[model samples]
Target: MGEYKPPFTITNKILSYISSISEKIGRITAISNLETKPHLRRNNRIKSIHSSLKIEANSLTLGQVRDVINGKSVLGEQKEIQEVKNAYIAYEHLEEIDPYNIQHLKQFHGIMTRYLVEESGEFRSGEEGVFNGSQCIFMAPPARFVPQLMDELFSWMKESKDDVHPLILSSVFHYEFVFIHPFSDGNGRMARLWHTAILSKWKPIFEYIPIESQIEKFQDEYYRSISECHIAGESTIFIEFMLSQIDKILDDISVQINEKNEYLPEAVQKLLEVMEYDIPYTSNELMERLGLKAKEGFRRNYLHPAMEMKLIQMTIPDKPNSRNQRYLRC
Candidate 1:
């Protein structure tokens, strides 16, 4: 087995920051589970935003991340659009599988890389390069080291018994794996997805935490952290950067939860509870579930009130009159 080395002083500073962030993650988890209509909506929107950001960040082709959030066909051609749609579907399905399972990881890779590239889920069998413009900046381990690195990662994840914090492990693993750049493409996105998977496995609040938004907010910092780690021969700076972002995200959610606790109405609150896990409601669906005779009445009395408070966002932003319009608890 290969022995892992501890990072030095600069790396220790990063780990210390991560420790602080991990402490707050517990608070964020508590706030997420609390009963509050406004906070629930805020949390849900954050989750949606983060998921969307993940898709944009992970895509091989470049486009505005906003285009993805607005549901525009930024990928252009039919084949490219189909590939992006497939990736979204696969990401949604990630909730159903265990991230710790190596099989599931490979499956995610398969779905993520399908049609985008020839290798897809398979690991690189030869040399790889990281480049900026015309210059190559760094090269990963030799081809022979690829399988062993993956094996060690899987084994560490499975056998870790020290109550090592999942978020910490996730940050560390994300940096290390991306550094390895095991696959031919999609390494950055895969690392983020895998981090979420690991966190969700540890605490379900991670399912709602939109870490990607924070990443997108500081994309340059994110890249810099990774590069710094590469140059310094330590994972600590990257870990600290990730943890600090998570801390801020959780803090934001906590404030939103507190505000929701103060002002959300009872009917709207109950609706939020009902739709906590499953969302995307139509007028008819709301009428059926709430046992109301008139769809308009239900909207005026229940849905509109929630919408006014921003507890629900319209699915059809442009065409409110469309029969296909749906409401999701955002």
Candidate 2:
């Protein structure tokens, strides 16, 4: 296969982003216990799915996305809910798919667009464009050229995997995927999901970093970056924007982990385990169960942190010092 080279120049801004992201990645991976924290991983996955879908105007709220992920039934538009299910299934198999394989890309698009599109796994057979309220913002390539274009892109990626940093490669792939608008539907979702797959292949920690959440927070800038790159005939701006988002996501996760660990220390976790979800218990009982003689120490370390995190709630908030005051796991 011939090499595929898209028009893009790497600038100082791009290099700076790549360097910052690398440092953040190193810092996050230095946390010895992070990978073992399944709760945090699951939370990040849910956020990733929800924010990516939200960018596409999927109406499911983040809470609703969590419920769906936990297998709890949620009431919503059938199609929107199905989109969530399909996207979840695709993400769940991130390790199984090769990011540089065209077939795997199509398979993921199939999984992501199942039941939502008539041609789930196939490239578009007709015209496609990025549209906004009756205006065509970007027109994709002709449909007939898609198969060749995709093959060349994947071939280039496979060949360049070692030479290119994944931060740049994934971001470039994302822009090119959107630029191609390959599928009849679900192009945006595919772009986001596939980029995550690319990054996860580079470093497994990325599977847990929900960069899409950061993208959703700056949706307008995201679109503008893409459009600017489209007009400029290069993906430099998009790559810069994506790497910035990735860096911000890492910062957010660091803050979240620090806050979570601070609020839920080992002592607080032990206290939580002893308390019932609904049953209220007095401070004396809680302290006694922990074999603690010092009331002030118990409150300072275990009780206060848990309460501040809202994992437990005071039964008598209005009378904190009352003799009858009690607390229950919130």
Tell me the lDDT of model 1 at 205.
64
Compose the digit string of candidate 1's lDDT tens values, residues 57-102: 3442323233443477574555445545555655566578676676
Model 2, 298: alpha-carbon shift in Å? 9.0
- In model 2, the worst 10-residue window by lDDT is 255-264
Report residue 62 deviation for candidate 1 (angstroms). 14
What are the clashing pairs of model 1?
41-330
Best by lDDT: 2
* Native-to-model Cα distance after best TM-score fit, residue 55 in candidate 1, in Å: 7.4
TM-score, prediction 2:
0.84
Give per-residue CA lDDT, model 2, range 23-107, as digits (tens). Answer: 8788777753455566567777888899999988899998788778778899999898899999899989988889988999899
Question: What TM-score do all the candidates reach, one by one?
Answer: 0.70, 0.84
